[model samples]
Target: MMPAEDLDAEYPEDDWLSLSGIQHFSFCKRQWALIHVEQLWDENYLTAAGHIEHQRVDDYSESELRGDVLSIRGMRVFSRHLGITGICDVVEFHRSSRGISIQGREGLWEVFPIEYKHGTAKTIDADRLQLCAEAMCLEEMMVCSIPEAALFYHKTRRREVVELDDSLRDTVRADFQQMHQLLSRGSTPSAKPSKACDACSLRNLCLPELMNKKSVSNYIEMRLHEFVTDD
Candidate 1:
């Protein structure tokens, strides 16, 4: 694992990956590699809706202060240790005597990051990992400990609180480390298609079914055989 202080010298700015890609990497490594390393993307309804939601959250002009809480939307953050960067959907700083001091703010403020998702919560831990990654970055940046965070799902209109346990943090770190390794090799992992593939925006682009074929000729021959059998 790269230490926070040595990350600059080790990973450097050029090696930094997208912090948001943690969710993708967690869900499917091949998907993350395709998008991040190969620079490929395809937008379906899911991705399109996510973009719309992200736009609203990224409206930097939408910040508000209510009571003792200051909510900043689309705040940019990065983790040197993890070699990742991204924009937080919303980070609420609550007035707390034990929190870190923010410029132009009267008292110290405890940081709480909330990630907004277009769809409702799922059985997968991708969303939680992403939120935890954001919180980890905030912790490093603010020099304060954040024990928990929240995920707001648009579909269910639910705010799910996630505990930043040691296990989750360990996974987040290990995933990034593995990402950096894959990126250095410039190799994309094989596709592991499952039920999740049905909802993947890059289904067509990835062509998971054809990924395991030894060669294009073999794939063509296989397709021809299938066609002949159907006839």
Candidate 2:
């Protein structure tokens, strides 16, 4: 088992990964590499809507105190051990007995990261892993233990709490290591079509249908032969 402190050690900034890509990596490794490694992106309706929603949350310029909870919007976070960096939508510092002390703060506060999603919760653990990654980063930064965090879904208008357990953390560590390896190789994985592909923003670019076909050249040759035979 990798020690928590070992994951906190800093790496070169140039090689830092995006914490947001955790969901993409969990959903599909090829999709993550295509966007993060190859620098390719195609925004569809769902993605466009999600971007807008996040923009609204990120645009807030100030943090505020609401009763015992101090809400910080658009918090920038990074973890050297994970070699990932990204912005959190909202991080609430709630007053608690078993919390860490903040500089110049009056009371002990526990950190709670809240992530915004444009859709309802899915059976897959992509969003949960993403939220857990943020909590991990916060844990490293603030030197506090965050047992759980919440995910707010726009479609459902509900917040779901996720517990950051040992199994989840181990999966996150392994996924990030695989992601780094994939980056080093600098090669996109072959397209493997699944039910999830239909909702992917890169469907057209991925060409899942053609992926199963013999070859692009063969497809073109067959089409040309049919055209010639008709004439």
Candidate 3:
């Protein structure tokens, strides 16, 4: 068995990373560095709407029991190994024999974490990655394995089940390690604009226009080469 200390990956409380930042990190490292590293922000309608949605879901004191399942809203969680802390939008505890016992609760209960999002399901794994990170936090705090979690999209009004596969878990771990290194160095990476930049809330503040601009000399040289080749 691994030593408890090594298993936990514990860090000083002050050094804990924000679990929500995982989504932004996965989407774009430069964007993550800008926000989390440099403390910069430029929110548009999309971000503001998402923020409102999150605020609505964050009823931390609320928990509902129905049948054999208990659902908790805005449950705070943390992981010692990942050195991250976050809140799950909703975590359902289902009664089961192969689960852990909860304080003041009867019988064993399995955990199911759910993350709420503003838009429809994304083609990228940004949201899924964040959900996986949240599961890691819950697993560490509860001392159990959360084999699966879910993403609930407000726009679609549907739930997408996510398997906590080895690949995703590994990525989550690796991403956090990279994030820590970047943060420790106080380095924000240079921007590389892409199609995703179209939807990024930080597009204006990130100055992708300047970064993407081609030099006049280079443009003229290329045009001359094209003209000569044609002749």
Instruction: Determine the backbone clash count of candidate 3.
Output: 1
lDDT per residue as tens, model 3, 90-182: 999999999899999999999999999998999989999999999988888888999999999999999999999988988888888889889
| Candidate 1, 137-213: lDDT as tens digits | 89888889999999999989989999999889988988898899899999899898798999999999889987565
Put down candidate 2 lDDT per residue, 165-217, tens digits, no spaces. 99898989888877877898897888888989999999887788877778878
TM-score computed on alpha carbons, candidate 3: 0.88
lDDT at 63 for candidate 3? Answer: 76
Instruction: List where candidate 1 sits over 4 angstroms from the true fold.
Output: 1-10, 211-231
TM, every model: 0.88, 0.89, 0.88
Q: After superposition, how far is residue 163 of candidate 1 from its true place, in Å?
A: 0.3
Model 2 sits at a Cα RMSD from the real structure of 4.7
Ranking by lDDT: 3, 1, 2
Q: Roughly what TM-score does model 2 have, to 2 decimal places?
A: 0.89
